[model samples]
Target: MREQIETADRRRLLSRLAGDYHVQTARRAATFMSRDIVTDMTILAITRANVRQITASPEPVAYTYEGVAGVPADGLRIPVSVYALAKDLGLPYENIRRRVKKLLDAGVCITVDGGVVIPGATVVRQSNLDLIAETQIATEKFVAEAGRFGVTAAQHYRPPTADLPKQIIRLAMNYFLDATTFTAKGMKVDVVAVLVLRAINMANISHVTHDPALAVTYAGMEEILPHEARQPTSVYSVGRFLHLPYETARRAVIRLEERGLVQRGPKGLFVSPDVVTRPDVLEGMLYLVALTEAYLKDLARVGIAYRPNPGSPG
Candidate 1:
């Protein structure tokens, strides 16, 4: 018989699932924006603001995921200033201004009377559509994986009349920003450090999630897998994967190691079980769980059904 999914088990599963989804989606966004993950984050911040404006308007037009692409460039896009963006992202004003300038030069964003907006024309592009499609696929995969671990949507839920995909994307962006901000401030690390550590964590457990036996064996283990089960990853590999410069990745890893958040071994690098079990790190994991639960509930509200498995009490 399969084991029950306890709170700890669910937290682990959700963390892994959210980590993978964030990395994949961030990579795609970076590619689409022709910029680094940080810049991509800036763009997401702007887009999130615009999305909010559209959704909050009393206008009669419907805003489905596809329909959003057809909306007028200036219809409901509430321009967000650099100061506001900086505040929202917890980044410096100069940094946000520089990124916004680059985006303006690249035509990825346009300056409006008040501030800037990711234009509808940009959103209608094939590349943007492709990015949205990829996010949709990743979102589906996340839901499926969570279901495998017995985290399913409630049966009585119903889909909302509003734009479900757009709202979900906004929720995801919010989760990413909130999680990044929380981890950076709580752990006394930069965004790059957070990404590097997450990359290492994902690398360490990639195999366990791939193999059926290992997946089942570790599904309820709340702590990190045994050292023998981990697949260590090198700094160079992480740098290449995240499109970060070698020295930048190296420095971040070194800082993480010095902080006792990462471990170095003969093979490569991995997050230590001790680090995973730390009170602060565990709190961050629970924060991630809370955000994920809220996200799932939103999906459930929109009738994206996630049923519990046979004989499982969800």
Candidate 2:
């Protein structure tokens, strides 16, 4: 079958999808997830807009040699217009935006002129009438390392499985957001239904299709199980996953277990099968289900392994 390449209209739709969470509800999610949902929503919108505007087509152009010919990997520097940079690299604007967002969050790209400016970002010269080829490659590499995604999940990452967990994670990250407890939030939504979403995202980013929710659940399992060792994940597991202290991971895991979204299986605590399969009782859960589905699908596409079985890495 022919692949559905991203069209302008599709890009527009994706932009909308990225920022669709409702205002009040997003606020609550922000509180629960750590980063303000409103802020993230705005970032989502801006990212889409910037990406759409800049990512249309990439072309190399001669540089006037502004501050520096190339952007430094470290230190702070504001970026130029999203459109101009994307064009200069001969790459898609979507790719540019994804990379910029990762760089921004990781403290790699600093915003200036409402976009990004890197001192040694790329090596371009006036004589060539284009950006140096190596510069574009470097920028892409930097972004890929930072875990960027596109409107479509399958095209999000290429050669994604080069590193198992990281590749899998980079693929699925679009859904992960900067949140602390997507798993718990998922329970209020339908864990089982979202499986389709994860599958679609996996197909999109990696061009590899699989069951969405189960893919993510499996991915979560991979995260908890290290190097094929399945220890009963404790609240400590949550903290470890979030890069926090043992207590924090424990607290959140316990909270979900108490809520009955998850439970201790014969092997370890697991997301309750009932919770995974059942529809959300809470009326507000619909939106969470949709958005979270989009996010996890993005993850699945990128080879983030998800083992549905407790302590199993699929």
Index of the highest-lDDT prediction: 1
lDDT of 2 by residue, 110-130 (tens): 576656543333222231112
**Candidate 1 lDDT, tens digit per residue, 187-220?**
8787778888988888999877645556666655
Clashing pairs in 1: 159-302
By TM-score, the best candidate is 1
lDDT of 2 at 152: 32
Task: Identify the runs in model 1 with alpha carbons over 4 angstroms from their true place.
Answer: 1-8, 56-61, 64-73, 159-165, 210-212, 220-223, 308-314
What TM value does model 1 have? 0.85
Lowest lDDT sum, 10 consecutive residues, model 1, at: 57-66
Off by over 4 Å in 2: 1-52, 56-232, 265-267, 281-314
